[model samples]
Target: MNLQRTQTAQAPPAPRPGPVLAALAAAQFTVMLATSIVNVAIPQIRAGVGLSEGGTTWVVNAYGLAFGALLLAGGRAGDLLGRRRVLIAGLGLFAAASLGAGLAVSPETLIAARAAQGLGAATIAPAALALTMDLFPSGPRRGRALGVWGAVSAGGGAGGVLLGGALTQAWGWPWIFHSVAFGSVLVLVAVAALVPPSAGRAAGKFDLLGTATVTVALTCLVWGLTTARGTGWTDARVLGALLGAAVLLGAFVVIELRRPNALLPPQLFTTGRVAAGNLLMALLGSVWIGLFFFLPLYQQQVLGMGPLTTGVGQLPLAAANIIGASLAPRVSRRIGATATVSAALLTTAAGLLWLSRISADGSYLGQVLGPTALIGLGLSFAFFQLTALAVDGVPPQDTGLAGGLVNTTRQVGGAIGLAALATLAGSVTAHASTHRTHLEALTAGYRTAFMVCAATMAVAALLAVPLTRRKGRADGSRTPTAADPTTLPRQGRATRRTPAA
Candidate 1:
């Protein structure tokens, strides 16, 4: 039988993104904004929401768990339902959860709402990515658009810390959640008026088991880490939770690899860049956010900076990160993705190594600025290039799942990084307090952690060269101009193509 030729259905074209893509991106901004905003307000959240040290972490953990776990499923759902439908639905749910979280009177309720917010994110992010794929189909223009999109997603997260600090200092922690609610309302309205109704198609039934397994596994691991905060890493429950998480996550991998409708294709992990890119994302994500988590302590407690000042002090990193993320793609196009990433990773590593030298009296201008800017420049070049290539290896049909995997790696990496850094800092602080002041020892712990971050990024940088330009693809993966460094392997030269959705 001859295949029926059909034009893919298009969104109703508007005179600009009056209410469509803008709304989608905004909703994304809001959902992402929520996670980082609370980081700055953790203290007030504990006091107001009755969050204990361990319990307070759940406020962040719950959202991350739900968000990370269901990401693949949400992508699948978007493909089955209309991406627009899934995107809008997710936005509405996110707004509702934000309202609940803002008014939460107890720790348990706050955690619950936070988890709900993650679910909302799970629903939205993948769908938004997929929709963007549909809206901006592949080409050079698409590549530039996607580059801008990546910057918005990344830069917005860092900005959220500053905004949250401002809001928390000026008003209260609740405004953080309320802010999301207001943004969501506007996004929802825009989406309704602008996004066309879709009779969407699905690949198959929802993968509830896959989603549940991932969620439980990540939650267990995080819970174990939280438990270790008080009970020690060797605690039986902590050990069991860690082991259980390992097994469950391993099972998730096996299941996904084997399933007919897998959450992620086994093929993706087999590629050099795909696998390596994900690892880079994981390592960088964990280490990057871990710094965000603790560096504030040095500012607030050691230097006696207020919340606003602490957030401002971080501007070096935040501002550089924005510049880095935005400029990275264009840089990669010139240097070749592999070379760009490798150089950037080296820069990041060097910065981290320098970061390890920070003392209580360490000047931000010397100790912080050089490393932060270096890391920013490096991260900006590396991540966007990797993102561009992530889906390049796959077909358009699998974009949603591919996008989910890219996202999943980052989430899991950040979680692991945060826990490892926190655990190490805790041990260092415990050991040092006997001889030195508590504050002094804590600063020592921060320096030690910075050393680890530096080492981690350095290792990743070393590995990126082999990963980006392997025996397979050439450095540019195309006719390498002086501007482009990544080439494809000779054998697959015919098969390799430019960026597609």
Candidate 2:
């Protein structure tokens, strides 16, 4: 009896889910907020730092390029090192970089700081997500936790626009960076205090060669796409960058296949619906990022709203996103994940179609609010479902890699989508400028981009059909595949089995 009592007393208590979830969610929110908070302050920042137009663009692109390119490395680092350790380090770096950005007086200084922020973000995102999965065992509770994760992440993107506008209008652009710096410090403290340490997975040496090739490949690809928006697709530099990215990517694949402990295991793609899920995620991300990009421009340029009003105007969409994310797990339980995603995509496509009809004289209430709300709801639903699907059936050891891959696809897709849509819109605007007024021509271009985004969503919806037959059981629940150890009864150690092809 004494031995039993002592054993019970020695057993560790389960972690408090609420505080852990909040800290992790806050970390994700801070990373995403930094992505868009600088947009509204670009004009002020350019003047403050004496930046040229190209330098102004770099201020935004530098962050994204670094963040997107280094995601895989960061994720792998979390797995090889420790998730909590990486998270703390990332937060420290992010806080310092935000402070540097706020204090920067030169174009070069600001851009470099922005790039450092991205690197920190890349480290934070995968580690935080992987830690979330680790702490929350797969079940209904995990589902709810993921719903909150999706909601806050979507909110951060929308909220950044609003917060950026308010901060810029009230206290100038530096305050945006200052605000992020403060938030990072708070989150870092919370994480350190509340989150428990997780041990690193036992693994072989880090895949330095695989990491380098893939990182440089992604950097070149993002740089090429971003540059194409300004210099056109046929430019020599753009072509060279794209070509270099392709070669590097090809080399990375070859190296991965040869390496015993690859940075990204090729076999993981064959697990469950991982490959298809990422493909769909890429498409969803393209539409998601494009909508946010074009919608704000429409509100400001076409409707003639100032930054503050435009920021306020996005509230409906943000509210709808919260609702949609809350509803996702419940809806997926009934209709199945694939069907839920398909329906969500169709809904978003319809919303985008409605947005395509906007005119220069359109009012915010009639033209923007309803459609944007619909799009926001559908986008949140699709993102929640797709994120689950992409990470489902992944092994415990590879969870960080799974997180990194999904994020990489989304970021890369956004870069490609934004560049293509911007170019297409520019061409349409140039053509319409021959006869239409300036506002009318700009409206025409925006309309064209919306139509294209709608079509893209529709295509993704159709592609979602195959996923149902592949991943679902006859009873409509996700099939308990061999790759997911959590699905097994906790009787003994679960054997790692390769999922069906």
- TM-score, per-candidate, Cα-based: 0.87, 0.91
Q: Which candidate achieves the best lDDT against the true structure?
A: 2
Q: What lDDT is reached at residue 263 by model 1?
A: 62
Name the TM-score of candidate 2.
0.91
Q: What overall lDDT goes with each candidate model? A: 0.72, 0.82
User: Model 1, 365-415: lDDT tens per residue?
Assistant: 757667766666666565566666555555555566666766666666776
lDDT of 2 by residue, 1-501 (tens): 999999999998877989999999999999878877876676678889999854665776688777877888888888889899999999999999999999999999999999999899889998998998898777667777777877876777788878887888888889999999999999999999989888457476688999889888877877787677678889999999999999999999999999998988899897777887789888877776667667777887778776678778878888998999888877766666768889999999999999999999989999989898998898888777777777777888888888888877776677667667877888899899999999999999999999999999999999888863355567665555322323434312333343331
